[model samples]
Target: MKYLIPLLFAASPVLADAPVVENITYSDGRFDVTLSHGDTGWDDYADGWRVELADGTVLGTRVLAHPHVNEQPFTRSSQIMVPDGVTQVFIRASDNVGGWADDTVPFSPN
Candidate 1:
């Protein structure tokens, strides 16, 4: 049991926190996204968000200044002109330690 405790503690850092998308709104070639994250601090926090195409082309990125420690979930907006033929995009959140979150928001350009 002693060994198990240390192992779990070591693995805790690997279990990085990720940002979750609460809501999304797209209009006039702009995107307003609401995200929820367990931001601890600057060392490991949701640092920024991005808009990407289906093919993985990054359209735009919104850089977050500080960690949203108090704000469990926050909303941010970005104005990006998607490609003409692009019908859909992905909204992804990035963290300092874990990088981008696995939760990719599929956005419809309607």
Candidate 2:
């Protein structure tokens, strides 16, 4: 009975807090994505974001250089070479600790 509580406590750090994509905007082949996270410091922050197709083909990525500690929600843009005939794509956000979030934003390049 005592073994379970200690194990859960030890494994608690593995439960990652993923960053959230607040909004996504596309214009003239550029994607501006906004993300919000509980960025305490360099140890935990929203690291990067990407533009990709529905099939998981990454079109472009922006690696956020530093921690936005004071800035709660920030916006960044990237230019992706969205191929022809691809009318829609997905915007995904990531954290420095968790890698990537399963949440995807469906966007139309219209």
Candidate 3:
């Protein structure tokens, strides 16, 4: 028998909302981030994401080149060098239409 798994994808046409950060993981000096957005077309989509410190300092950024119409809640990775004394960081995702999300996902790389 063949089994199938379900995927969570929410595609919206409203351009007033930002992409949501579905999940994130940290390893060594890199982060694998998953984001979900209502990407109708090229005019609006999840354009970028960034890693930052508690003090609002950005460490790294991953920019989405195009719309993920079929692949909602997509995952991408990027590397950021944390300072010697830093223990944790936060992630913020943005869309071309709505900019950054209201809440941020916190992560600790220890």
Candidate 4:
């Protein structure tokens, strides 16, 4: 059946795995995120990253516009307005190939 062929292909692994968060830093209403491939090469993949509040609210999302062709590390910085009295933020990275990763950070808005 036509559906069988598509289903079989869909179940097959094609592209590389998604990147992992190497480190996260937050300060003064801003945050920096670092990502790296884990034993796999993700040089040809395109992905988007996002930051969220503690209550599952999205703060911002950044789409990677270039292919990471080298083994060198990938870093992205974002400026966000943390909600007043909020003490934590969540971050996620998603690849166009349907892989994702998330992490959380604790901070104070002083």
Q: What TM-score do all the candidates reach, one by one?
A: 0.83, 0.88, 0.81, 0.68
Candidate 4 stretches with Cα past 4 Å from truth are 1-15, 38-46, 99-110
Clashes of each: 0, 0, 0, 0
Could you report the Cα RMSD, in angstroms, for every candidate shown?
2.4, 1.7, 10.9, 4.7
Q: State the lDDT of candidate 3 residue by residue for 57-76, as single tens digits.
A: 98999999999989987999
For candidate 2, what is the TM-score? 0.88
The prediction achieving the highest lDDT against the true structure is 2
Best by TM-score: 2
Tell me how far the alpha carbon of residue 28 in candidate 4 is from the true structure, in angstroms, after superposition: 2.5
Model 3 scores worst on lDDT over the 10 consecutive residues at 1-10
List the global CA lDDT of all models.
0.84, 0.87, 0.85, 0.67
Please, what are the lDDT tens digits per residue for candidate 4 over residues 15-79? Answer: 66666767777777677777665433354453667778777788887777665657446788878
Ten contiguous residues with the weakest lDDT in model 4: 37-46
Clashing pairs in 1: none
**CA shift at 31, candidate 3, in angstroms?**
0.8
Ranking of candidates on TM-score, top first: 2, 1, 3, 4
Off by over 4 Å in 2: 1-4
The residue-by-residue lDDT of candidate 1 on 20-58, one tens digit each, is 878889888778888888888877778889998877889
User: In model 1, which runs have C-alpha deviations exceeding 4 angstroms?
Assistant: 1-12
